[model samples]
Target: MITRTQLVGAWSLESYTETDVQSGEVSYPMGRHPEGLILYTFDGYMSAQLGSGRRDRFKGQDPYGASSEEYTAAGRSYIAYSGPFYFDESNGRLEHEMFVSFFPNWQGQRQVRIAAIDDDRLHLGPDRPMPFNGRLKTASLIWKRALPNS
Candidate 1:
């Protein structure tokens, strides 16, 4: 059985794909090689960030100077949130409490994910359907353990 201690570390995104519940179509919102990192701290805090394969730079390399269009483009390709998190050993699930988020709606929300680790990879499941380009889809996120710099 996996314990809370096993989850305390940095995990690198391996893949993120959304599958339609009805039609069974899979979509990669962040391309095949998107970048993301999820971290868990012993102090009971957690944070996650997932970015599209590549992002465009803001005008003059200054975000404050960017126009609304630039901001919209940037925001569309990123997913970020952070807060205290807890693990339920009996159920092997994680309750991710979002104190803040790039998507305003997630703030103050507690999201549950079925968690598993197989062959050194962490799989978060119970992929619930959500809006995806006008259709409902479930996201499947796969993560690998982050290794220290060699």
Candidate 2:
């Protein structure tokens, strides 16, 4: 049983893999080498941001001034959300009670993940396949603890 205390800190993304429920086709949601950060605070708040490793730069320097194509590209390649989080140590479950998210539909959602920690790495995944793109797929994400200076 992993305690909340053991999870308070920043973790760097190692991988994000998805498996199609029907076809068993495994794919990378954020490319072969994605980038992300998941942070947990002692205050019980958590946030996560994951993105494709290679994102094209917007034509304009100002973020708000990017072209529609750039905005679409950016939107398609990133996922972010934050909210209060809790751990059910006995069940090995982590819950994210999302207050907000990049996908508006997920706001106010209670996302549950089965989690395990080995060495400095954290593995998280849903118990069953959830919707992605337009189908059901199970996703497993791996994260590694950040170094003190990282």
- The candidate that wins on lDDT is 2
Q: What is the lDDT of residue 52 in candidate 1?
A: 92
Q: Which pairs of residues collide in model 2?
A: none
Q: Write the per-residue lDDT of candidate 2 for residues 31-126, one digit (tens) a residue.
A: 999999999999999999999999999987898999899999999999999999988777778998789899999999998888888989999888
Overlapping backbone residue pairs in candidate 1 total: 0
Superposition error at 130 for model 1 (Å): 1.9
Q: State the displacement of the C-alpha of residue 144, model 1, in Å, after optimal TM-score superposition.
A: 0.9
lDDT of 1 by residue, 1-150 (tens): 588988989999999989988899888898899899999999999999998989888877776888999999999899999999989788777889999999999999998887888867888754377787789888889999999757
Pairs in clash, predicted candidate 1: none
Candidate 1 off by > 4 Å: none
Judge candidate 2 at residue 100 and give its lDDT: 88
Off by over 4 Å in 2: none
Error of 2 at 60 (Å): 0.5
Q: What local lDDT does model 2 show for residue 13?
A: 99
